[model samples]
Target: MTDSNMNSHELELLIAAWLDGRLDDEGSHALQNALRTSRAARETFRQYARLDAALHDVADTSAMLDLTKLAAACVRPSSAEQSPTRAQESSDTEGSKTERRQRPFMQQMAKGSRVKPTSRKPIASLRMTPWYAALAVGILLVAFLIRGFSVDEPGTESIADLSPSEKTINTDAFSKVSLSKPPAPVAVLSSVEGVIWADSQLEVGHAFFEGESIRLEQGEARVSVGFGAEIVADAPCSLKFLSSDRIQLHDGEIAVDVAPWAAGFTVVTEEMDVVDLGTTFTVSVEAGEKAETTVLRGVVRVHPTKIEGEPRRGLLVSEGQRMSSDGKGSFVNVPQDQDEVQKQLGRLDFGVTGPYRPVDLSNTGQGLSTGDEDLHWQVVAGPAGVFSEPQYASVCEPERGYLPNDPDVSQWISTADWRTALPNAVYTFRTEFALDGYDLATMQLFGRFLADNGIESVRVNGNPVEVQSWVDNVKYQAFGDLQFRFVNITGGLVSGRNVVEIDVRNGMMRTGHVKDPPLSPIPNPMALRVEWYAFGRQQGIAQADDGVRLWRRIRDSVPPMSMLSYAGPEI
Candidate 1:
């Protein structure tokens, strides 16, 4: 359901149903569309997958048992029917016959086909005698124990005890991994999608016996593997990673920020392998499909290793540079800010200041500008910027203070007379047009409208939420070659009650809940300074365009009303 109040976990569950073959075709396609291009969302999917796998490991140990054999074993031989002379002979053959019977049963069990079909109604099975059931369960447990199915962690439930209905718990808790679930191993099978995660190093590639070790199916994550983490795979489509890393990405687009001492970090993609040269970067790999890597810091060694073990004999990707490989023999060096590259690699087109920073935009603790301050934005600079400019390097600087919209901030700003000087990029303006008569409000919205029109995911509270992409979330016409995603609402801006912030999505989710609603313009969280009229390209410009010519047109042609602006020196 695409309800407005749907949380991240709910949305992730929707995705899980689609991945688990529980949803209808229309729902499945809709879920895919809902998940397209969201790296964090994809990472979330992987987390759900991991969680699902972990719980499954605890619940579905039935395959390990030969239920048909168990059913047969329940029928024991008659002890009274044997004579003393015959008993000795029978006893002699007993052990050997048991082993012989077990041999065929074990073979069938190994093939995963000998397990009797679970009754149509599980309740009937539940109604069976606890002694027999317990024995069957004990057999399953022994089999699992022989299989070494003991979880290193405790109280996480035993796989043998899991009823099929309890499976939803794992899928439900995937997107938002809280402290509720204790530390445990989450494994994914070849058939399972979006159900795994790797928060730390993988000492051996043996972790994934049948399928992917950790599938970054949806959402985003920050993974820091020590030198010990070594990931390797055989089948192509099984392994995946969304772009959640701070530097080198394994599956989806991930940004890696390696500590200076870090070493031996390698991110493999369908196309090529971008090894970490003790640098920070983001690489994205999708669905055993396409892949792209962008280096934000340090360096990445890119070579033509179309196939594993073939020397990665390509070129080096330097800092602030990028490359694209799709596992094909050829790899292309993709330049920075390339729209096609960003779109394909699942990077957003909006201005994302890496990590959320609120104070950089305000100080008085009052709301950023016009509307609610809860809808904060995070921008990651693709390339370096100029002097005194809001460049990537500058934004990455330490003096920027705590993340602006971070949950740590206790005081939320009100929409009264509060203002502060921010970087030009955060507060750029034009006298051309305003949203209704609200110059400041419209100016704040300019950033949002522009950001929403050109990106994949955007943040509306601190958490990164989903929205329609730039192309799909638009209402525009040829207004002198300048295209705009106009929001035709008015009342929201006046009282700052209807303030909205668009989610410029950088990636999509693979599992959990899946939904997409129309991209309606929300009220501006903060206001900007600039006087002008609001203009729509003959395409429903709801607000006024109090005809005034300025150097440039404010972003969305929606300027804040002049009714309530602050006077200099604190109100």
Candidate 2:
């Protein structure tokens, strides 16, 4: 019968026949079509296959005798060497005497006599005996009894009597007899920085279950949902874990970093659902106002929630784009502020306490030292053009304004005494750092520096950066008048090793004096003070590339007796 016309009873019979190797070609075709088109049919087939296997196991273990050999032995016995008529003729006189002499045991058994053998005989030689036949009957009986006890009872309804759906229910129940179910955690709290939960106390490495709500009162928290998706939730935020790949942002802001394999990671808000199309993005909810989404890298699709009777289509927001949506289904493009977004990304405080220390370019407080065997800062160029021998800058106290001092966090360093340095001459100082185990794409390198006598230019890894120097003039500024120049060197940094070059120009001196000379008569005093830190998300704990971990190590390494400190930005 065709699959469409076949009833459940018919399908069950066909499956049973197939399992028993008794199905016809038509039934086999119908069963195949049913299994291909219907899930129930396939499940039934699986259950039948399992039952067939169990029956075969029972049969293999219990029935070891070869029935064909037993039948051949019974029909053609080894005693057939003499003819029946000759044996009858020999029953009297000379023939009887000959038979008695040739086959004494056979003649005695035919005369209804009980004969006892001297020794035991092999089973092959005793196959045609009455005792052997009786033993075979007993073995068959015991095998049937064992099978009857192991299988269903005599009065119970067989599988053929049950409907297809009922059969599935019974089979499923049997399969699940030894199975157990356990609740699965959807995400884990990988890192927490100054986090204060609203009600419950949570620590780092906490596992979160689906449908669980988290209310953060202060600080940043990062949750690692599987599939390489991580969510960093800023304080005053409330969120719910919907699943491993999705979360609902009730309030506050959260930045999501989706690895390539986690493209469908989604952030749900009241206004819209921000689905990652393989990107890094931030989603924020303004209570009842609107939801804003900013894409830092890659792309995302912002699907607005339905409002009243209106259905809205999703908007594609690419890298460096920001979009905001009102709960009423209105979408507007907002100007993207990448720097602010980057600062938010930087705030992810992975509490990595590590073996890799932060790169220090300062003159004091674990900064560039003169007595160290491995020096970081070297004077590459001076008044003599190029130094034949490597010249290392020595830490020195500044004669003028707030130059880094021994008591401060960073100290000033110069190649020679400022008084002896040539006027109008430029000195280039270079420092090298290695980012051995960091993820280069997400690394953030930023710091500040102060220079005396003015800095002309700054280059990172031989590439120029658009950084404004704190002082550009050769003239001296008043004490406490020096300002620190902030530099973000992320764009110019390389993966393994990096170099930073700073060119400081000395002021021109004047000969004869007046009240205020056009240039200072005394020789120009040149010194440089630098304090910078490099940060990045480390790939592993042992690699020493975790920015926060390295930062903490460098900060904590400072002596307690000293007044210097290396505190990072507050969350």
Q: Give me the candidate number with maximum TM-score.
A: 2
> How would you encode candidate 2's per-residue C-alpha lDDT over 20-50 as one tens digit per residue?
5667778778899999888888898899899
Model 1 Cα lDDT, one tens digit per residue, 1-571: 4334445776676777755646666665555555664566667777887887765433222221222224433453344442222112233343343221111233343464664432221211211122222333345556667998552231121111211110111212344221111111111111122334444323211112111234343333332221212122212222432211212233544454444433445565546666777766666677556687777656788755556666537578876677776556657786676554345334421111111101112212223332433233212222124213321111111101111232222222222221211112132111111223223222222122322113333332233333344421211101110212333222233322222333222111011011211121112122211111121111122123322111022222321121012111100
Clash number by candidate, in order: 110, 2
Provide the lowest-lDDT 10-residue window in model 2.
159-168
Q: Estimate each model's TM-score.
A: 0.23, 0.33
lDDT of each: 0.32, 0.57
- For each of the candidates, the C-alpha root-mean-square deviation to the true structure, in angstroms, is 28.7, 36.2
User: Any runs in candidate 2 off by more than 4 Å, and if so which?
Assistant: 1-182, 308-312, 346-571
The per-residue C-alpha lDDT of model 2 at residue 543 equals 48
